[model samples]
Target chain A: MNITPNEYNEMAKKASPGTKSYKTIPAAFLVGGLICTLGQLLNNVYMDAGMSKDTASTVTSITLIFAAALLTGLNLYNKIAKFAGAGTLVPITGFSNGVVSPALEFKSEGYVLGLGAKLFVIAGPVIVYGITASAVYGVILYLFKLY
Target chain B: MSQRISKDTILLTNAPSILASAAVVGKKEGEGPLARHFDIIYDDTTLGEETWEKSESKMQKSAVEKALEKANLSSSEIQLLFAGDLLNQCISSSYGLRDFDIPFYGLYGACSTMTESLGLASLFADNGLLDYGVAVTSSHFCSAERQFRLPLEYGGQRPPTSQWTVTGSGAAIVGQSGKPPYVRGVTIGKIIDMGIKDINNMGAAMAPAAHNTIKTFLQDTNTRPEDYDLILTGDLGKVGSDLLIDLLKHDQIDLSGVHQDCGKLIYDLEAQDVHAGGSGCGCCASVLCSYILKRIQEGVLHNVLVIATGALMSTTSFQQGESIPGIAHLVYLSDSKGS
Candidate 1:
């Protein structure tokens, strides 16, 4: 087992499917569109059931998040996300996966530190910055109205 | 031969041959483009176990058994088993491989465990220390995620720079006699820290170490990027892969044509929703056993250089706000040399 580094240096493919950046446009558009369509369908169904549009939209988002979290607990969302990619991410489902994946991953650590703390590893920033930005915008609108 | 070459490289004169190898992956990996290359894919990540950790252990055990079976060998034929994982104390390897009677040497290189174990197993086989040995490693998305990051039930978001820990196991059997694609040598790396503390950004943390290892290997061996048909890095993902190129270019070494990262190869960026691609010990292990070794066996590739890289960071270290340390190990696998 003795030799030269130069020999090792001499040692050393087609872009195998996994190595190269995969072509994901069709899958992304198709999956993303399908999820949105599903949301629309759910909204229509809720409206037809006599719920207001605003309430139906909110309920639809809540249902998607609930479904995503449930799937995450069953360890199915990651599988779907794998196939859908941006399709899953662009929709509300992606955000739900973001929140659920880490929480599920951290279950063994304990409730306080693992589940409660790490629950927002992905979406925490979005919630924080998102709420902050909205509040700032609200204040600006209020000032503008007064002027 | 005494087995010492330059500062970090070891040349194996006897050149142990890889008789067979097997890759067992989770459902997500099974859906990837190289699905056909894998030997087994589990629909259930837990492999029917009560917990993900136990399931990962079962996966490792199955992978080793499958590899030996493919080689037409039995447990008695293997003298030692070199295995590891990204779990605490390498439990995925220890508990998984415990049933086997072979002498066990558990290793830890985080994602680079594949090359680290391969290097050791090759050293033992090539030097006549053993007639045969198995180099195996595994990482589970759930098991590793829970142990290394957070609980599975916790709702959290992963940053764009983060990589998905692959759930898979790969085992390779190296014996005194076999076909080509022999183990030529290894360049064991030294730990390097460039003061990168972001656990989410492995590419930034590990790129410098890869550069250091590659430079050492090149200088010690007096070889250029053109010498090898392929230069593969383990789990550098896209960002780290780019950084490796830029760092090497500073030394006038361009790896544009030959370099590929296993992390970048294992998942789709957009379609798979893998931000920086795949990581963990299984990232390099599964891909190397399936794709790279398959091509070499087909004679599509002559000589190849595989430098598996690892980020030596733990949840404790990150929690303490310590900069991550990185290492890279080089192994030369060639199809033409012995033949």
Candidate 2:
């Protein structure tokens, strides 16, 4: 009845089942690889259509984002994600979902307050950190060049 | 008069009877193992409502209406109404039962609300405070997920220990006089925190509270696990149930024989992909109001101990790195009014 929190945590750890990393890791790898391969294929196709390397890369990203958004709207992304684990997560598609999901979910609250404000609820931190880290890197690069 | 047997357990002298009960669930729950037991199973999760919150309110409203209809009483006749839901501000109960105009008591015991409300209603009836009282609670999977976890469209995999929030509602009407399946006693539980920070593993957090309450109730009543036909727990799922049996074993009590969790009972775990099992206030509420109560009414189960467990933590508290506190309330229902 008076088990310490530390003691209880240890007991609970033994009691609860953990994620099957054996299965999840492979699934994540395969799915993530497939998504990246698709992006690469799109980049090649865009380049073949007379676009430059940068344009092709940008267009490929747009295409992947569009596909992810479409899948999310159709409610297929989550089902696939359940099986794929980080396969669906550590990709451009995941970022698209992070933005689109809250936008769609909070649309019930209204366009201005709900959809707009909650648009980045999940992806906001990622964007914030990404920019902050890039700014720091840029500062370091400038200092190195001056030296 | 109802006597206090111990610090937490109370022996109800005038045993209040569960006159009528009803359960209404969504599409997923209807497709689950207890599909046939539910009174009304809506093919649409929305129940023709626009939003998931509104849908949850509609389900609660339907459950209350169905229970009242089965008892052959209107909302006006019910002296007290105890209702709650797993929503902020208890919006589902307040909005759902607004038209009834009954004196309402909105409760927020999280998932334990079903038994919490039932215990209070039984105590009020036992004390001769009211001729009729209704206890009802609900939870919606979509609504709870959006509030507590993530948006429906968010592509995130749930951990193995995670539980699916049951989209359903259950209502029970307790009267001063009725047939069998009477509320013999009640044992209120204390808050038990086990320093569990994983929100996905609610069972582990709640199992200790359940174990404490069950032990307290058995001690107060001076009865063993063998005395009851069944010991039902609310939504501990597979992981928590296993831990509960193991934890009780330390006290030289074996619950493996008669213990069953509403979480495990509600779903076909292998086929349903519900991870650990079904949870939320609606999980046990719907199961008890339908399957458990029906068996009790049919004389199949003689004595039953229902301990509904709750994880008392909010998204804010969890975000603030606070441990989840668990509570479980025990309600002893028996065919005979035991002395």
Candidate 3:
């Protein structure tokens, strides 16, 4: 109960475990690859439902994002990310985690001012530039009547 | 009234000895590579407190008490207490060390509070301002998240560049004698901003400041990178550490072999999902006290330069679209000589 500082240090050093990484990379690869496979599975399911390839791919992405957001909201995504490392982070699920995490964290500041404002704190620029480039390219193609 | 060796550098002729040091960390850090070096590791983030802020306070209190306990000295022996935290207005330190009757000087240097406080403490001791000085600093991941970024429950996807705010505390006891490792010199950093506005990427923002301080310290002390066995930066994470290496490369100063960041050394990034690595006042604070100092005591290292860097930006500043400016404080610790 009244351990001296030196004794405390020795005790803690013995009780605490060092960081182990023998299986981290393989696990990350397996989990990350599995997530991608799940995405492919969803895409195939959408195509089997008679949707076009583009539509199916988009639907699959949306589905993954939705699932990831739900997990993040339930505080389950971080747990998966913790165990899976880059497996959870490298996927579209990670993107969803990025977006939903801040929104949820800022929820206490109110919906519009807090959650809504912080919604793009991390992912704002990517979405903005991504669609902007797409729109600009689309306009250029239209000008050439490539459509 | 001390000898100024160079611009922004001080020579502590009266080498202040580190009588004792201690650290307390959270569960994640408890599982880190330096886990065994820490004094206490709480499995719970809240550390049994009602809120995260209170938990961070508890960490600081415990670290100071442990350091004092280790030195076999009472709080009364410490003439001055230099403490700080990541919280706004330094509430964590003020709230935590309230019961201690020692004269307190609260500081705020974002993540670099450890070195800032230590540097100042040694300066005070060298100037005969105090016979014994105690310095401490702390940071918690949850508390920092809620204040600087988001809440714990939020599922924000961390970027490859984002660093995990370390949940820990470190306290050091400094006096004129009674210790082997001594504080030799200090180099205070000037605020450096490369106009990086992204709050998610702190490593990039703080790297320049660290680079500047290291360059200054080397030039001021007329020492080369090879002089020290370890040249550790506080918390530049993976990205910042790389940036510092690149920045140093421009000056033709190579420290590739001996350089390491506390951010990278403290965590197993590839294993732990802490994307970039750990960053915070506690990042270097806990790591230095537990792992680095322990190595010195064991004669594993001879001289070490701890350049603790900080990104001095508030959540309000980031919200207002302001760039984050960075600062660093240097502390040279040696083992072979009487410290």
- Per lDDT, the best of the predicted structures is 2
lDDT comparison, 2 vs 3, better candidate: 2
Q: DockQ of every model listed?
A: 0.12, 0.86, 0.12
**What local lDDT score does residue B191 receive in model 3, on the 0 to 100 scale?**
92
Question: Please, what's the RMSD in Å of model 3?
Answer: 10.4
State iRMS for model 2: 0.9
Compose the digit string of candidate 1's lDDT tens values, residues B1-339.
Answer: 436868788888887888889999999999887789999999988799877889999999999999999999999889999999998888889999888878999999878889999999999988789888999999999887777775554434466678899999899999777687788888998897777776877876777778888888888878898988999999988878877787687788999899999888888777887888899899999999888899999999988889888999989889899888988888899996443
lDDT of 1 at B303: 83
**Location of the lowest summed lDDT over 10 successive residues in candidate 2 chain B:** B175-184
lDDT of 3 by residue, A16-116 (tens): 23334566677689989999999999999999999999999999999999999998888898877766777887788888888988888776668998789
Tens-digit per-residue lDDT, A32-106, candidate 2 = 999999999999999999999999999999999999999999999998998898999999999999999999998
Indicate the worst ten consecutive residues by lDDT in candidate 2 chain A.
A1-10
What is candidate 2's CA lDDT for residue B95?
96
Shift in Å, residue B326, candidate 2: 0.2
Error (Å) of candidate 1 at residue A110 is: 9.5
Please give the lDDT score for candidate 3. 0.85
Q: Which pairs of residues collide in candidate 3?
A: A97-B157, A98-B157, A101-B154, A101-B155, A101-B156
Clashing pairs in 2: none
lDDT of 3 at B75: 91
Model 1 accuracy (lDDT, Cα)? 0.83
Alpha-carbon local distance difference test for all models = 0.83, 0.93, 0.85
Q: Rank candidates, DockQ, best first.
A: 2, 1, 3
